[model samples]
Target: MRIVVVGGGYAGVLAANRLAKAVEAEITVVNPRPDFVERVRLHQQVAGTAVAAGPLGSMLRAGIATRVAAAHKVGDGTVTLDDGSTLDFDYALLAVGSTVEPMAGTVPIGSWEGAQRARAALAALPAGAVVAVVGGGATGVETAAEVAAARPDLRVRIVGSPVAATFTGRARRLVRDGLARVGVEVTDDEVVAVDGGDVALASGTGFAADLVLWAIVSGVPELAAASGLDVDADGRVLVDEFLRSTSDERVFAIGDCAGVPGTRFACQSATDQAGHAASALAAMIAGRGPKPYSVRYLARCVTLGRRAAVAQFTHLDDTPRDTALSGRTAAVLKELATRGAKFGARAGFGA
Candidate 1:
């Protein structure tokens, strides 16, 4: 069987790697970039602590084919790329993930190049200067913490909307409390605009900042829409409980790209989806029909600088329980998780 995967982000790459070992089927991955981005560590890239790019060829297994171009469309069983390329397959998995959203007057930082500029731009700020990070979601929280930890000179302020209300129990408390204790200025008010190193608050208050990082409005690739696949209003592929797209049974979606009900977009969730897809594909290769996707998360860890963090271990029901740890202990957990991300690098590159 010939299987094709599109957009080698978290979901796509993981699916490709797992399926590579699962079957003797020919596999092809179509992605615009040559390297697999460590998207979870992108905030560190924005903070200038990590090099932004790694070659894609280094990440793939020996048998999988890699295409270095944007997927322009999907026709029949083929995925069309930006440079007039078409790839056909018997089975397809869509893992086109989301992109960052820019706030008022602020350019979004998503890609490595954009994040590099953002890091340099912030670097130019005077010592002990104030920086504004809008959005209180996981990305925003991680960005704020990474900036504070990586560069102690800058004052970090997080402006969040009531949507911050979405996070509950231990996870919510952990993030908010972690930010507060670590010197992040938590503002509940909305942002009205960003201009001339000043963040305008919805309450008509203007706060001066050395740099403004917009971490809201994360979006997805438009390839699903272009490919004539049915997409939700948010650009996510609507998938069934089994992670197969309802519009095309030959197509499957997962990770941040798959709009799984009641699931938040996070790397842990993507990893869980990756595991799910791995089993399903193994089933398919073993001469059984493809099984549906399922997800279960173990823990959620967010760093507060390098010394402190909030670890929320959860049950299968999504009920979060607190496992707060700080100092060297928490630092080790954060480092371990970061190292876990490196596993994908190995799966792609193969030691």
Candidate 2:
């Protein structure tokens, strides 16, 4: 069997590695870059505190081929690369992951490329400069705290919707306290415009920013839609219970690009989905029916710099619970979880 996996983000890498071990197939992973990006640690990269990427070859298991090119199109039983090369396959996995396009005047820290740009821009700024982070989700809060902790001299503030809005009331309070402990000012005002280093708020208030970082994820790649696959309104490929594309049984979609209901855009979910897809694919190749994919929510961990964090326990369906952990212990768990994610991807133990 010949299998081609597109994209090498958390989902793509984990799926490729798991598939390599689960089935007897010639696996080839197509990625735009030669390295695997640890997207969960991108905030650290922007703060100059950690390196989040390594050679892709080093992460994948032996006998799996790597193509350092973007996937231009994924057709039936074939994948077309950006350089006009084509690879024929019996099956394909579309795991292109998510993307973020910052506004004209803002830098983004969502993708590997954006993280590098943010790092350079942040490094060039002088001390006492105002750094405004737009968005109040996990990425936004993490980026604000990371930058504030790494460069205490800089004035860093996170402005947007409520910070950590997904967490429960107790967990949200913990996150707010953690942010305050790290000297990050939290704002609930919506940003209406970003122009010429000035951020205009919806309430008619504005502030001069020396640097602006956008932490919101905009959308996924257009490859699935462009290839005529059945995608949701957000352009994520719609998949059935088995993670196989609805329109093409030969293709499976997982991770951020897969329109799987109840799943969030996190490496934990991606790896978990990859593990299930591997098992399902293996079963299908063995002339047996594969089980439907399902995931149980464990906990959500958000790092507030290097010293503090908040871990919100969740029900099986991902709804937050009052039971939570905070401070150093939570930070340690967050670190362990991140390391475990990398190890799981490398060892093909995602399931």
- Candidate 1 has an lDDT of 0.74
Give one digit per residue, the lDDT tens place, for model 2 in 1-351: 999999887777788888887789999999999999999999999999999999999999999999999998998788999899999999999889998978779999998999999999999999999999998989999999999999999999998677788787889999988888888988888888899989998889989999999999979999999999999999999999999999999999989899999988888778888888888898999999999988777998899999999999998888888899999999999999999888888888866
> Could you tell me the lDDT of residue 20 within candidate 1?
83
Off by over 4 Å in 2: none
Scored by Cα lDDT, where does model 2 land? 0.91
Model 1, 157-236: lDDT tens digits are: 88887423545675577578778777788888888888888788888897888788877747787777777778888878
TM-score, predicted candidate 1 vs. hidden true structure: 0.90
lDDT of each: 0.74, 0.91
Best by TM-score: 2
Clashes (N, CA, C under 3 Å) per candidate:
5, 0
| Model 2 / residue 205 / CA error / Å | 0.9
RMSD of each: 2.9, 0.9
The deviation in Å at residue 82 for candidate 1 is: 1.0
